[model samples]
Target: MHDEYNVQAGLNPRTVREYDEAITRVSLGYKSVDEYYSNSCSCHVVQHVRIPLLCIQAANDPIAPIEATPYSDIKDNPNCMLIVTPQGGHLGWVAGDDAPFGAPWTDNVVIEFLEHLQKNASKPESS
Candidate 1:
């Protein structure tokens, strides 16, 4: 499914292969896939990301399953919200039958969240 999404997103197959090779070369020192996957330094280090985080997870996403998402940790953070949709296969919620790109729902939800954040941010702080 991820492969299909990559292809659909206009990623050249050769480019994908090159990316895989790059990762493989960089991971040569790792003892195992688990070791590579478990490395904390390898993950994105976002310190004090003040912006509100809205994580949208598709319940049926095979690539990023619900259990795989660090939702509990995200929700525990002061500035984060996790939304899980029951449908939409791994970023497959293409909006409108004739739409050229990704799902309409994705845009709608993201926009709504941003608007809400903006409105709330503009409000004067209470003494």
Candidate 2:
């Protein structure tokens, strides 16, 4: 279903099945797709990210399954922030009071977060 959306949205030039076949032949070197995804997939690379990363995931996103999220790694990492909202399917957090500037809710979130950082940037460290 998510693949259908991607193809319909023109994010991918080929259908999901064709994309999978192309991935298998050109990108994934392992015999099994699971093994290739386990090692080379972007979803599995969060543990290696070294910067402050804010990840926003919808609890009911049809495109990205909740099971694929790096819950444990995000919980264990100080540099990672994971926000799983009950809504916002596939980056659709738009119409809300928080969205004051005709921007997406995620944009508002990042704007507020950056404001917080800027406001607190000059404070001294607490012992």
Candidate 3:
């Protein structure tokens, strides 16, 4: 099912099967493949983010390959930060004390980022 959407179905209109069309219709409530592609692609709107946006992507992720990353779009956005690590598969940032088990390394990174935000929230901006 996952492959049906990410790999085979989402490839192109020519590659989309009847099963994929039905799944998109039922699950996503999208009327057509064109609509699905237009709405589902983040590259279309990532640059429009008004707030600080942190995007951590694994360079070797199989599900969402690094080549598809919106590098140019994100680079132009002052509020967006894109971090592409050499490793970490999909959501598998297994490291720190949690290696081989427990939470991912992103837990600590996210917490630290939030903590920094909280600490700096009260500070006045420099002229």
Candidate 4:
């Protein structure tokens, strides 16, 4: 993603000059590549997702690693659930392996959750 952004920025002459100036001013005497990479996680935003969330993570996803995802913090929420699978490969999990339209695991899980919500919603309310 970062590389793609860099390429796009380079293609724009104005952006290239702006970026070069900014980097020259900010980098100073920095030598290592680690200094330029951002290390912060968006856990603060995760803590604020008050809606009923069903996060499905592909166990082998390289971009969105299961271990780095903010599931643990929100897992205790009554309205939240995290389903981690061994396959899927990022957002590439297709359903029905050889079928025309893959049988995505997300489809079943989301449908079940919605059904559960509908069933519960139809229950009579107590006075």
Clashing pairs in 4: 95-102, 95-103, 95-104, 96-103
Q: Across residues 24-108, which tens digit of lDDT does each residue of candidate 3 receive?
A: 6446767665566667778989979998788899998875678768999999998888989999978988976747697888888
Among these predictions, the greatest TM-score belongs to 3
Off by over 4 Å in 3: 1-26, 31-35, 96-98
lDDT of 4 by residue, 31-97 (tens): 3223332233445466677777778888888655666677767675666677888988868767665
* CA displacement after TM-score superposition, residue 2 of candidate 3 (Å): 19
TM-score for all predictions? Answer: 0.60, 0.61, 0.71, 0.59
- Between candidates 1 and 4, which one is better according to lDDT? 4
RMSD of 3: 5.9
> Lowest summed-lDDT stretch of 10 residues in model 1?
1-10
Candidate 1 global Cα RMSD: 7.9
* Candidate 3 overall lDDT versus native: 0.75
For candidate 2, write residues 1-127 as lDDT tens digits.
1112223323454444345434542343555445645665446677787867788999988656577787988888787889998987887888678564577768878888778777877888889
Clashes of each: 1, 0, 0, 4
Candidate 1 residues lying further than 4 Å off, grouped into runs, are 1-31, 40-49, 96-103
lDDT of each: 0.60, 0.67, 0.75, 0.62
Model 2: how far is 105 from its true place, Å? Answer: 1.4
Order of the predicted models by TM-score, top scorer first: 3, 2, 1, 4
Candidate 1 global TM-score: 0.60
2 or 3, which is superior by lDDT?
A: 3
